[model samples]
Target: MSIVETVTADMKTAMKARDKQTLSVIRMLKAALMNEKVKVNHELTDEEAQAVIAREYKQRKESLDEFQKGNREDLVTETQAELKVVEKYMPKQLSQAEIEKIVATTIAEVGATGTSDFGKVMGAVMPKVKGKADGKLVNQAVKSQLS
Candidate 1:
């Protein structure tokens, strides 16, 4: 099923089960997906729908970091819960080791020898790991490999 349909189905289930948290997250996701659809003026491919979900997941992660830094336990707990709901649709993330390996291989392929080659290495690396790894972690791995 397409993500839009899946979200709609899950929304129904969440409502029937009285799962307020899941319902809320699903509704938010539906809205985000719909907005993207309207913005682009076309039906979203599954990839586009997944991208919207990933963006939501990424936003929550950033918020989680801020909440932790601020020592706001209440908001931290809630954000983490929201992250869990969002994560249900995310592609399985690559491990650090896997990202490093990809960086190493790409660095060699691009002949990126120093930090000066940061953009070169990144340009080559991002696509190989797209949707599979976190961009921050990929950046760290590439920097370490190049420098």
Candidate 2:
């Protein structure tokens, strides 16, 4: 089934199981997906759905970090739970090694000899990594490789 359908099905399962946290996260994701669809005036492809989920995942991670820094353990735990629920819909994340390999190949392909070509290298690499890796990690890898 498609990610949207899977999310919907899981929402029902969460409701049935009385999983409040999971249900909330699933509802939030569904709303985000619906908003994206409405904005584009069409049904989303799997890649688009993944993009939406990735955005949600990114938000959760950011919140988790902030909560940790502030010593808000309760919020941190809640955001972590939400992140786990959202991550079920995302692609398997690439490891540091995998991202490094792809970044190296992309830099070579784009003829990016230094940080001067960061944009060119990033444009070429982002699509390849997309939902599979975090942008910050990819950027760090590219910078390390270029320098």
Candidate 3:
């Protein structure tokens, strides 16, 4: 099923189950997806839908970090819950070791010898890693490999 349909079905289920937190997250996702569709004036491919979900997940992670630093346990707990709900829609994340291996290979493939080649390495690596790895993790792996 398409992500929109899957989310719609899950939204109904959440409503029936009285899962308010999940319902709220699903609603936000649906809105984001719909807005993207309207913005682009076309139906979203599965990949586009995944991108939208990934963006939402990234936003949640940033919020989680801020809440943690601010020592807001209540907000941190709530953001963590929302993050879990958003993550259900993302592709499986790559482990750090797995990401490092890919970055190492790509660095060699691109002949990236130093930080000056960071863009070259990242350009080659990002498409390969894409939805499977977080960009921040991939960046760290690339920096470690180069420096």
Q: How accurate is candidate 1 locally (lDDT)?
A: 0.92
lDDT of 3 by residue, 32-142 (tens): 999999999999999999999999999999999999999999999999999999888999999999999999999889888899999999999999988889999999999
The lDDT for every candidate, in the order shown, is: 0.92, 0.93, 0.94
Q: Name the candidate that leads on lDDT.
A: 3
Ranking by TM-score: 3, 2, 1
Alpha carbon lDDT at 102, candidate 2:
97
Candidate 1 per-residue C-alpha lDDT over 1-147 given as tens digits, one digit per residue, 9 for 90 to 100: 998898899899999999998899889999999999999999999889999998999999999999999999999999989998888888899999999999999988988889999999999999888888899999999888877
Give the deviation of candidate 2 from the true structure as CA RMSD. Answer: 0.9
**Pairs clashing in candidate 2?**
none
Model 1 CA lDDT for position 65? 99
Per-model TM values vs. the true structure: 0.96, 0.97, 0.97
For model 3, how big is the CA root-mean-square deviation? 0.8
